[model samples]
Target: MKVILVNPPIYDFSAYDVWIKPLGLLYLSNILKTHNIEVVFLDCLDRSYFETLVVKPDGTGKLPSTIVDKPNILKDIPLKYKRYGINKEIIKNFFLENNDADYLIISCSMTYWYLGIREILDIAKETLKQTKILLGGIYPTLVPKHAYLTFTNKVDYIFVSSNFSELFAYIGLDAKNLNFTNFPAPDYSHYKNLYYIVTRFSYGCHYNCSYCACRKIFPKYTAKTVEQFVNEVYTLYNQTKCKNFVFYDDELLNFTTTKQLFYEFLKLNLPIKFFTPNGLNPRFINKEIAKLMYELNFTDPRLSLEFTSDFTHDITDKKITFKEFEIAVENLINAGYKPHQISVYLLAGLPYETLNDVFHSLELLSKYYVRIRLCELSPVPKTQLYYQLGLDDTVDPLLHNNSIFIFNGVPGKVKPWCSYEELQLLKKFVKDYNESLKQKTIHSYAHY
Candidate 1:
């Protein structure tokens, strides 16, 4: 059997390549190869697809994009809608060339980016008329009914289950026979030029925050042994000689195994840098762990501090407290990390949250030396906040987009918490506050 796995382009107001790779699709590729099924992978968002783009030293860069017309739903938004990836003609030509595949599988990430999947489905249906096409990933998994209705005739099937048992059954295979204990690392060999690799030490989160979808996607928390995690990292590093590694774990420091993993990493003594794009739980960071992370060359560490107000504790499940956050910052700074090098993520535009609440959080964060990242909330389907707002499955997924959600909340369902102007002012406040700290650091250095 032959299968073509595709990572579709993202259609959004803005997009960047921050060590983003199709890790799930690559893992599926390895599984297919184990069954002797031939796999052909195409990543539309691959940086190597466009040779003219520049990449930074840490493997983070911009993607090649072309401005496209916005959908009628988003027409009022001032930002230019863009298709960030290889051109449509390139995708069409590739499908035409490889039309003989028996099955075509496409992966989707953000629910708001389904337009890219629709485009890929249209092209696939036109070129590979005889092949069966399947769509699966975060989008479809979260809103299966909407996905099925949206692409009713375009896709042959939609895989909603995380275990891939339904997919195996449809393809005439028994998933129960496969052993997951020896699951292979994602097949990064498909990429022409690899820069950084993304891996996870754990599978899911133990806490179920109302705004998060991690619990919905991964119902149970599971982790790989420290030995297994370290061995996989060593193997990938030896193979690609890639020095940058990013952890996609929702809770990188929540478990005891994480400490062992860090010690193992330190023992390697390899000149590699680590990053955590997903913010870490501040409650887990201690003096010892902070020291270990600093020794291991972890860069740009970000802590998850969703809110400062006590009333917001119910929504965040009280995962972190102000005292814990302060202690974590002090530990990191004492471990030799400058305050400006640390970052704290503060969420904005949440339902029932006033602009004063956000501003208060920002003002509190300004007291610290760390930088602040104000994240606008995107109402994900099936999350507790989504249901609390009375948003049903019938609502268009486009309404969940963070870019326009702040300015224009669901027309009749929810009112805008803050206007675009207010959001801009809040951003400026953070920028100026961070800049003040930077100048202070410079002056202190000169004085010393």
Candidate 2:
């Protein structure tokens, strides 16, 4: 049997590769390959292999563009919209040359990225009309019903959960003994070396943070054994020899099972640096964990502090108190992490958040000598915040971009949403804050 996995084009206003790689689909490809199944990938986002490349303005890399039918909902958006990937003819020709795909798998990200998803499905239906289509990833997992409703007839099946083993069962493959260690390592060599590896050491989180979809998406919490994860890490390190590694686990500091793994990594004392692109759980870290991370040289650590005030305790996870957060920062600082090395992700634009709230959070993070990573709130479906916002389904999904902060309109305006002026001010404030920190860092270094 032949399987083709695809990461469809991103149709957003701006996108960066940002160490992004679809490990889930590639891992499945490895499994299929191990079972003697021919696996192929049509990575539409891959700039190197794509035929019709559009040189990005910033010049970091190129993005492919293909003229396809735009979704009806986004027709009014005044943007020169083109699917960022090789054109239809090129994709079809590539498929013909590499033909014989019995099954086709695609990965989806942001819930609002369905435009790209729809385009890929239409192409697959037209080109590989008989092949089975399976779609899974963050979007589908969070809003399975929305996906089913939207792509009901367009695609063959949708996998809501992240368990690849269950997918094997759906396709009648025996994967009873499949474990994390047995899972195929991502086929990163197939694409350009991006110098970063995204490895999920744990499956789920123990805490049911109301605003978090981690528990809902991955109901069962399990971490790969220390030996298994470290071995894979060492193997990938030897193979790609990439120095930077990113952890995608919702909770990287697994207090119970995975602490030993991190502890062991500290003992090994590898020189390779580590990163947590997805912020770490502040409540899980202590002096020991902080010391271990410092020893392992975890650069650019981001601690998730959804809100600094206790007012959000009910709606958000109130696991770590303000004092606890300070202590955690102090521990990292004592362990030799520079102030610039630490950052905190504050969900800035929740539906009812005020400018004062945003200002206060910034002040708190600044006091800890940590930079702030501001994320505009995007109320995903199934999460409590989504229902609280009462988002109109009729609204364009493009508006769902966190950059827009659609839910958090103004305080007392007729629209009852964040005003354009207010949003602009918030953006400016964050910009000024970051610039101030950068200038301060330079001045301090000069004095040193």
Candidate 3:
């Protein structure tokens, strides 16, 4: 049987390539290939079209996008809405060329970017009437009822289960016969050019942060053995010659095998630059791990210090204390990393969090020489914060966009915690504070 896998375009106010890939879909493709099923992969957000767009050495870059009309719910927002990816004409031409596939599976990422799925569905229905279309991924899995109701007639089926049982059954394969543990690495051969590889050592997070959906999406914490992970990375690096490798694990350092995994990576002695885009837990970063990460060339390591105040403890589950953060910073700096090269992610615009809370966190962070990466909270469905606020599934997912949610809030559901101007001021404060740090040449040991 022939199957087509598609990674839909993103419809958002702003979008950038931070070593993003359809990892789950690529794994599914590998499974299908193992079962001797023919697969055709199409990534709508492929960055190859924009030849002039400058991509960094680490493979992060901007996507080629075009302005589009905002939805009625977002019309009042001042930002321009964009369809960030290849043009629809390319999708149409692709379907016209290969219309004989028995099944077409479309994967989604953010819930707020569901419009991209709708766009792809329209094109698929018009071009391939015989193909059975299926929608899956974060959008449908998080809010299955809404996804089913929205695309009731458009899609033939919606795969919402966490495992591939339902999908295997639909495709006439038994789940018990497939080897879930030994699946091959994600298939990146479909793309003409490879930039970076995004992989995961673990599946889920042990900590249930109120604002995070990691536990909700992946209820159990599971990890690959050190050998399994190291071998995969080594093989992929040799195969693609891609120097940049990113870890998408929700909890990279918290895993039991993490330290050994890093030791194994260090032994490879390759010139690969590693990254942890999903910020690491500072509490787990001891001196040994910090030194290992430095020797392994971990670029701009970001620590998760969502808030510094005690009031936000319940929201963050008291993940890391300020003392722990200070130690992590000191450890990295002592291990040959400059304080300015380290970054901390401070979450802003949380429920019940005031501007003063954010300002205080920034004030405390200013004492350190690290860079600040401010993150705006986007309430995800079924997360602790979502249910705590008494939000139902009826709320439009588009309102969950962090860009406007921090400023406009949810219409008639929730009021804005901070106005647009206040958010801008906070951003400027962070910028100025980070700039001030860059000018200072204080010794790391002296500061401690």
Candidate 4:
């Protein structure tokens, strides 16, 4: 049977590619190839399709988009919402040309982009009406109810598994023995054109922050062996001559794993640049790790300091301390990294958080001479906040959108302490603060 795998577009206020690839869908394509099933990969968000791409040298790029009408619920955001990706004609033309697929699988990410998913599903209904459609990935897993609400009538199934599970079995493969060793390396050769490569050295995360959905998506923390990592890196570089790589792991700069991975990295020393787009934990950075990162050509290292002070200890679950952040920044500086070479992520727009709190945090962070990234909270489903407020993704996926959520707070419980104008000012302050500090800036790298 012929299978078509799709990576849908993003409908948001702003979207940029920080080495974001449909890694799962790519892996699934190879798995289908291994099983001798004919696979057709379609990416609605293809960056290379447009003539003028905002792609940087490090594999990150800005998505091509058109300003879309704002959702009724999100009209007060004061920013233009967008449908970021290739145009509708491109999606329709692809399906129109190749409408013979037996099964169509779509991968979902960012719960708030549910509308994008629906748009693609609607296209599938119009063109590939005879074929079955399956939805999987973050959105379907975290917000199954919402997924069903939006897609139940248009699509045939919602996949909530971390693994292929019944998907492989349904495709007539022996699912019981499927593992990574036997799995084919993700096939990106089919992309419209070349960009940089993205790989994962680890899966899941060790810490379970109140704001994170890592535990639900990836229950266990798993790291690749040195040999596995080195071999994969060499294989990709040799095949594609792509030196830019973004590590997709939730956590990789930890003490124990860094020691092991660095030794192998030093030996291989493939002529490649590395990026830690998935914000590194400040507490994990030490002198040795910092030195190794610099030597290994790690660029755009961002420290994840969710909150500036212990005031949000209950909300952040005390992941890291201010003292720890200070040490990490110091270590990076001491290890030959300029203050501007690193960036720190601080959370803003949380429930019950005052603009005064963010201002004070900014004051303290600015003293360090490092770039500051103000992460507007996009309260995800299945996290502590979601449960605390009794919200599922079904409440209207648009509500989960950070672009809108940044302006409005939870419907009834509490509104953001800052007004829409105040929020804009805070965001502007962050942009200006980072602009003011020019410590060997290595381009902006966002983790999510």
Cα lDDT of model 1 by residue, 339-439, tens digit: 88998998898875788778777777776878888788999988898888788898788888988788888888878778888887777777777787867
Candidate 4, run of 10 with poorest lDDT: 439-448
List TM-scores for all candidates, in order.
0.95, 0.86, 0.96, 0.93
TM-score of 4: 0.93
Model 1, residue 392: displacement in angstroms?
1.1
Across residues 206-281, which tens digit of lDDT does each residue of candidate 3 receive? 8988888888777788777889889999998998999999999889997558988998998899889999989999
Clashing residue pairs for model 3:
none
Which residue segments of model 2 deviate by more than 4 Å? 47-90, 178-182, 391-399, 407-417, 441-448
Model 4 lDDT per residue over 60-100, tens place: 78888889898888877778989888888888988877798
Against the true structure, candidate 3 has what lDDT?
A: 0.86
Error of 3 at 418 (Å): 0.7
Evaluated at residue 218, the lDDT of candidate 4 is 84
Ordered from best to worst lDDT, the candidate numbers read 3, 1, 4, 2
Top candidate, metric lDDT: 3
Per TM-score, what order, best first?
A: 3, 1, 4, 2
lDDT by residue (384-422, candidate 2, tens digit) is 665566653444455565644443332132132455566
Clash totals in order: 0, 6, 0, 0
Weakest 10 consecutive residues of candidate 1 by summed lDDT: 439-448
